[model samples]
Target: MKAIILFGHGARDARWREPFDRLAELWRAQHADVPVELAFLEMMQPSLEEAVATLGAKGAKDITVVPVFFGQGGHLRNDFPVLLDACREKFSQITLSTTPAVGENVAVLQAIIDFGASAL
Candidate 1:
């Protein structure tokens, strides 16, 4: 089976998880047949390694890691690639593909405009 892991940069504030978890649930509903997992880069449960391991254990031989983060910042440019390299070594049997960060998408620009319009 194929798995998709949504990786987020964790926050110290507990409330940060609420929205992520909700999004994960929504994704799961949309893709009922595909396995979806959530992971945090730091300050949260289910770190990247753990999530990858779980997917591996669940018979996911092919996995795609998607970053639920904004911008091509340090996490995307540096840390995330390193993490994926390590994960590749650890889960040698699994084929992993990392998607581009969400913020770079055109839809995100529209969403930001809508939010700003609503705020005013």
Candidate 2:
């Protein structure tokens, strides 16, 4: 089976996990057959390493890591690759693919426009 691991920038605020977890659930609901897991860069329950290991343990040979960040900042350019490298070493048999950051899409631009229109 393949697993989708949604990676997010962790926040110190306890409430931050709520929305991230909710989004993970929504994604999982859309793809009921595949396992979906949430991991944080910091200040969270499941770090990326832990999440990937859990998925590997569950027999996920192909894992896709999706960055739920706003842009190609430090986390995307640096931290994520480091985590993926660690995951690679830990789960030697699994093939991993890291998807682009969500903010790079046109839909995100449209959402920003919609928000601006509503605010005005």
The per-model lDDT (C-alpha) reads: 0.91, 0.89
Best by lDDT: 1
| Residue 83, candidate 1: alpha-carbon lDDT | 88
What's the C-alpha lDDT at position 29 in model 1?
89
| lDDT (10s digit) by residue, model 1, range 46-69 | 988899999999999999988999
- For residues 1-120, write the lDDT of model 2, one tens digit per residue: 888998999999989889888988898889988898999999887998889889988999999998998889888898889888988988889999988898888898899899999998
The collision pairs in model 1 are none
Predicted structure 2: clash tally: 0
In TM-score terms, candidate 1 sits at 0.94
Best by TM-score: 1
Q: Could you estimate the TM-score for every candidate? A: 0.94, 0.92
